[model samples]
Target: MSSVWAKKVNSSKSGFILSTRASLSRASIVGGALGFPRIRLPTKYLGMPLYKGPKKSFLWDDLTSRIAARMEGGEAKVLSPGGRITILKSILTSMPLYLLHVIVPPKSVMCRIERLFNKFLWSAKGQRRIHWECWEDLCYPVEEGVLGMRRLQDLVNAARMEGGGGS
Candidate 1:
């Protein structure tokens, strides 16, 4: 029965020879991408082919290495609070939220605008925005008619604390 089946397949006018080669090529192309290099089965073995040897997994290894390298480059750098404050001010002034809306209207942009407005309250220019109210007043909780901005004075005091208070 096996001999008859093989004879029928090989003797077909449909050109099984070309089709088999095409199938092998397609399988190899897909298997190579999946890190399984193609291996030629011995003609004597009708079934149950063995895994010949190590199929170089360089494609998979190289892709993973590139992703790891990129993550390392984007690591955040530490900066002084004062430096952060200056950078925030520059971003706000250079590209106000309203102006940014024309270029890239996004929810994050609106959030940033809100944050900058809050920062203005902590800035030296904050005093000029309103009279008879210190920067702390504007930062007070909504119940106090302020937006609950964190107190810069407290942060400064904490920074100057002896032995980094409350370790």
Candidate 2:
């Protein structure tokens, strides 16, 4: 395979090495003439992290931290409820939309995001307030006496369904 690829490249580069997560035997290593480099199990490719199996908490650590950092920027605290909602809809939710399109975030992660939005909506200091309505009711259309705030889980589920193509 390497020989075929080398033929295609036809380059005189001497430092060519094979980097893979596969386990190769000693004889195969000698036959391939490829140098193996130690690599971590999961690595980033094209900005998306690559792993061997299902998504896990560790895989989401960077994304979670990014969301936390954004929330901690103090922008949410200064805005009024309406302005906070606007920012939530336009900036905060959109931050993770691309990732949601690719992977269904865990419930805990979604809950943390929702908590941040909830705090911004109800209180200026990020504290919990007396609820006038349930989250489901709050997410309803404005005509229905609600704020029309789209739920993150619903969006994630919709994206998953869309990607699955009616299956």
TM-scores of the candidates in the order shown: 0.20, 0.65
For residues 1-167, what per-residue lDDT tens digits would candidate 1 score against the true structure? 35544433322222111233558667766655554444453211222222223422331233233333332232202333354344434533333323222222233333333444444434342132333454345445668765444433333334455243111
lDDT of each prediction vs. the true structure?
0.36, 0.65
Candidate 2: which pairs clash?
none
Q: What is the C-alpha RMSD of each candidate to the true structure, in Å?
A: 23.0, 7.2
lDDT of 2 at 3: 54
In the range 1-167, model 2's lDDT, one tens digit per residue, is 35544444323322222346444664366435644333354765444566666655576677767766776677666777778778777887788788788767667777777776665567666666775665555777889877888887778778867542111
Error in Å for residue 44 of model 2: 3.3
Model 2's TM-score against the true structure: 0.65
